[model samples]
Target: MRLAALQEDEYALLESDCLFHLRLFEAAAMPVVEPVLQRCLVHSQRFKILNTEPDSRVLLETANRHVAIVDAVKSGDAAALETALSHHISTIVDFGPDVLPLNAKS
Candidate 1:
């Protein structure tokens, strides 16, 4: 996605999800979510802080990437957004059982 193709509504919806995921889990999706995140840290200068502690950096980076994804979504690039979303879903499915909370009422 070029970021210009996404409709306003689509961008808004994806942006919301990205923000929510960042708030809840620190990362929107794994592996696929990494690049977007790295870009943000590099752009935001948080990457330097991350280098001081790899483990902590990873956690923070994940959250940063979620924000980046939202930015990308807002960019309105349909292809990029679609790719990001696809990877996000894949990451969720892969880690779903471990990370997802079971229904307490069950």
Candidate 2:
């Protein structure tokens, strides 16, 4: 994942990103929710790659976030893990292209 990010290969980076999340769902052993996550991931893939190639800084930060998640998990730091997860989620939401702000007038 870090390698993909440093290389600036968005497709590979995206693959790693998806794999990381999917693995989380798999590890959780949530049979029903896993499929729902899959569908959501498909949209995630579209929103990511279908937009302009992401900035390299975003890719690097993403890689760092993944590492932080793993570190928290390995250390059994639930609070840290939640923080990392929240950061990752917020980063994705904020950086997403074609995603309109809720307060924007229609």
Candidate 3:
């Protein structure tokens, strides 16, 4: 997706990581964002290298997951979001303040 498609607030939310973007997107009433967030959650589960600089494999895996989820959401398959959430709640919660704040925000 082009950076131009997202508002500054949306971009900031995205840059904040999986949980932040997920909660913000849900609060903003854009269900389409759920799948993308799910993909991020999944990617976070598969990789653990982020704490030690960057790795191309990790980045690529994450990006690929994001693209797949985005495509699924665009096609209106909301079930994918639930599937992702169920499978990766730990990763989602690990995003710390991002996911935690979602409870209060809601």
Report every candidate's CA lDDT.
0.48, 0.83, 0.49
lDDT of 3 by residue, 1-106 (tens): 2231233233333344555446646855867777776787556544543442344444444444454445545676769865654454444335545555555875
lDDT of 1: 0.48
Best candidate per TM-score, number?
2
**Candidate 3 to truth, TM:** 0.38
lDDT of 1 by residue, 15-106 (tens): 44444645433544477776676555344344333343334333343444455457666897878877776665565322235554677535
Candidate number of the best lDDT = 2
lDDT of 2 by residue, 1-106 (tens): 7888888888898798899999988987999899998999889878767765577887787678788889988999999988988887777755547667778848
| Steric clash count of candidate 1 | 6
Q: TM-score rank, highest first?
A: 2, 3, 1
In candidate 1 the C-alpha lDDT for residue 99 amounts to 52
Q: TM-scores, in order shown?
A: 0.33, 0.76, 0.38
lDDT of 2: 0.83
